[model samples]
Target: MTKKVLYRIATLLGLIAILFVSTASTWYIYQGDTPEELL
Candidate 1:
């Protein structure tokens, strides 16, 4: 693939990861747990 395509894919993956982490943290907070407990 071209460099542009690869970069786009990487950017998309990063955004998805950020969204997933945020959602997980929110869920943890809702459950009365600190995110640190996930470690």
Candidate 2:
């Protein structure tokens, strides 16, 4: 029971981390592109 709970918690944390990384990467790319488009 403890193992299953730990696994679920780990999976949730990993997904959260992945989402955070994806958001940051997308934001960074968007910021880089907007300057060129404006010019």
Candidate 3:
């Protein structure tokens, strides 16, 4: 594959990973009983 294609794939993977992490963290935070528990 070309360098440009590889770079795009890497960037897309990074974005997907970040999105997954944020979504998981948000789910966990909301699952807590109180807002204070988030701290």
Give per-residue CA lDDT, model 1, range 1-39, as digits (tens).
699999999999999999999999888779864578667
lDDT score, candidate 1, position 36: 81
Q: What TM-score does each of the candidates earn? A: 0.75, 0.79, 0.77
Compared with the true structure, the alpha-carbon lDDT of candidate 2 equals 0.91
Supply candidate 1's per-residue lDDT for 14. Answer: 100
Candidate 1: Cα lDDT at 29: 76
Per-residue lDDT, model 1, residue 39, is 75
* Root-mean-square deviation per candidate: 4.4, 4.6, 3.0
Q: 1-39, model 2: which lDDT tens digit per residue?
A: 999999999999999999999999998888754666667
Superposed Cα RMSD, model 3:
3.0
lDDT of each: 0.90, 0.91, 0.92
Per-residue alpha-carbon lDDT of candidate 3 for residues 1-39, written as tens digits (9 for 90 to 100): 699999999999999999999999999878858667656
Deviation from truth (RMSD, Å), model 2? 4.6
Question: Deviation in angstroms for 8 in model 2?
Answer: 0.3
TM-score of 1: 0.75
